[model samples]
Target chain A: MIEALQFEFMRNAVFAGLLASILCGIIGSFVVVNRLIFLAGGIAHAAYGGIGIAFFFGIPYIYGTIGVSLAAAFIMTAVTIKAKNRQDTFIGVLWAVGMAMGVILIDLTPGYHVDLMSYLFGSILAVPSADIRWMAGLGAVTLVLTILFYRDILAISYDAEFARLRGVPVNLLYFIYIALVAVSIVFIIRVVGLILVIALMTIPPYIAEKYVRSLMMMMVLSVLLSVVFNMTGLWVSYHMDLTSGATIIMVAATGFFISLGVDQVISFSRKRKTQRSSRKMLKTKKDAL
Target chain B: MTQVSPVIQVQDVSFSYNREPTLTNLTFEVPEREFLAIIGPNGGGKSTLIKLILGLLEPNHGRILVKGRSPRKMSKIFGYVPQDVNVNIQFPIAVMDVILMGRLRHRGHFGINKQDRQRVMELMTMTGIPGLENRKIRDLSAGQRERVFIARALAADPDILILDEPTASVDTAGKTELYALLKDLNETKTIIVVSHDLMIVSSYVKSVACVNQGIHYHPKNEITETMLQMGYHCPVELIAHGQPHRILKTHGDF
Candidate 1:
């Protein structure tokens, strides 16, 4: 197990997992806060259209998926913003349409013999150095952009109308957020594939949310938790000879439940302590009387 | 008392959604540091007028100016609190974190610094919720939640504060406390509140703008049945001391 780190594929997988964890944790904080989990899921699954387009047009998958996913994300953002009350219905419809389009287009690609499971369940063991580089570049860009627009994003995510009143360019920020999610989703798909991407993007942050006091803190904790989950899951998959994506999701789920249990136990102990203290005070008062 | 320039000016502004008119030929002005209450029935376009002034919705005709400039240009000068604060409480955000959001325009794209934290603390203190700075927003009561939003608005230190039904969901005591807080704030800034509770507005506001489709301005003490009828398009009775209020007959159309 310790010797696995020397292998090139293992090194690439570990690097990619760590990088992907940071990106997912940061963006997932926003996605969970803004209730964009469904939208992010939609965007992720929708990137398959880009994959199909790439196969058909014989272009690189990354370029095709990024471009197509960005366009879809923009459209989703526009529709949701413009028609505020009716956003869910529109997003749901788009989600289905995007998935259907991808499946159909992929079927039409001439003489294409690509393994679908690799794209669906992920192939972390097959991660190449080039993909790691792409993930690193995208991760760095996301970090810089998030740090720069931290305030605006925080404002909009919490209260959009208030942000608009403060002279923040709400619409522009909205579009930028969706675009960032698009980029994040593209890389996230590379790690967990479109099928399990939502869990990877949401679960760690969801668990981290309970303990953090600020959004930045939540992001930090989430990234750390995500890395732990991803790395451990990767290690488990290597030893057990199981699927990498499923293993990561299982680890995240375990973390979420453990956090919940810890919270419950802490609350219960606090309650018991308070009750004990109150009884002691009562006994002391009775003796004094 | 020295009078400052009007912070908000509306002239012949008309708005509609889906070709259905909501506000028609509405005109009003909110002088600087003036506490104005806009009261009307449901679907009477009070919120619409507020939105138009806030530049959330564009009017089909006429103009609105904030700080002597268009709403588009003077966005930063205004702070708004909407009626419904029903946010997903499960959302992972802290109280001070929410208040710090109001400093976005000042901070621009970068994250909040030490000064931002100090300002948020100050606003929380001003709103009398200093203890809530570290609390999760979802754990707060309705009144506390309202104060958090108020603190967020005050964080910007804007020239104007616009609130839609700020006291609607809170208890009676909370309503009284909130109105008193607003009254104190109005001494230094313009406040435009949209509310249906006329008694509270009459007690706290300096002036009132009654709107159904258009707007009719009146001094707080001088509000009458005729004016209420005209503005609300319904019969109104000023029940003195709650001794079975009598409904005044509706006036004839002009």
Candidate 2:
């Protein structure tokens, strides 16, 4: 792995993965706690429509993708808030429609041949220096904004109505947070692709949440956990010559199952110990009687 | 002449959702340090009135004023404890963090100082949940969770504390302890609780407001027969105050 890091593309991949991990760790914590994974996944899949528009219209991919995802995000947010019972149905519709639109538009684009499959499964080894710069820029923005509004975000995520009453600008913060989710979808798309984005965003945080006591710790631990998965996956995939995106997902899923198993074992032992203690206490009480 | 302004004033406030009126032509006042209770049937606009006072909703026709200022402008002076409908039970947050979120809107110069930590500790002790700050909120029982929320509400150090059905999920013993805590807090802060736990709350509140489409306020603890008919929109029995689960009047079937 160290020898491979001498290559420029390998270095870019590592940098890209690092940036993606940090962004996912922070944003993913909010996403998990706020239960916005489905909506976030919808935004990511819908972003493909933007990618298609970008290719067909001969525009920059970033602008087109972020624009469409943001629109999808705003619509999804409004629907979830207004028609909560039908939120899943609307998000599902948007997800499929976005994918379908992307496929159709990419098909119609004439002359310029592109490997569209790369956008789905991702080509982490092919991450250019420009994409790394974009990821760094977006990661910085995410970090600053999260630090500036950490308390407000925490308050709103816990109890929005209470936050509004306390004048935390709940609507403004909510919309801005969702918009960031849209932008961050573009970030994950660069490394893991839209198809596999939610796994990287959700699994680490879900595991971190069970171990941490605060949202801040959850974000930090989740980032560390994500970095470990990315590095391990990249190393394994490099050796075996496999797709890096799916490999990272496999690593994360493995970690997920291990955490679950460990949690079950801990609880099982706790129950057995409590039962033993109770039996001893009962015997003592009987002997005393 | 010198006069004391009301802590909260609602003058002919009306509100609706999608053209369906929930509250209409309501008028009321909550004075300083008063323990007030709001009661009504479900969908009778009790929660709506609380929202209006908290500035979460605007009156369609009239106006609401807090300390002679707009509720929105004086928002820093109000502390709210909501029904917590969307509280994610699996959310990974400690009791300390949950309470600290109450101070989010407070404009501290340095941010989260030792003073804030001290205040949180004092509130935890006062709320009877000390030594549990490091515990995860999900690890708490329903009763302990209620105390945690109450501590969070008090963390803001606001003059007016508002709660909506705070004891709904709490057990009978927890409910009594919650109301007793509110009564103790009312010595310094003005409290307005929108609750249906009438039997338990009546003994603690100094006044009562029955909200239907309209509002009828009695500036004393007693509930009149007429107020029950107006609030429930039907013939209803009043369970005697101070004696919970005891029906003061029941039909001949019993």
Best by TM-score: 2
The recovered share of true contacts, given per candidate in order, is: 0.74, 0.81
Q: Compose the digit string of candidate 2's lDDT tens values, residues B13-87.
A: 999986899999988888889888887778888888888888878889999999999998887787787777337
Interface RMSD of each: 1.9, 1.6
lDDT string, candidate 1, A172-282, tens digits: 877877888898888778788888889998898888888876788889999999999999999899999999988998998999899999999999999999999999999
Clashing residue pair totals per candidate (backbone < 3 A)? 1, 0
* lDDT of candidate 1 at residue B114, scale 0 to 100: 89
Across A1-289, the per-residue lDDT of candidate 2 in tens digits comes to 9999999999999998899899899999999999999999999999999988988899988888989999999999999988889999999999999888888888899978567677877778998898889889888888898888787888788888767766777888899889888898887887888788999999999999999887889999999999999999999999999999999999999999999999999999999999999999999999999
Report model 1's interface C-alpha RMSD after superposition on the true interface residues. Answer: 1.9
The candidate that wins on DockQ is 2
Model 1, TM vs. native = 0.90
Question: Clashes in model 1: which pairs?
Answer: A148-B109
Error of 2 at A92 (Å): 3.2
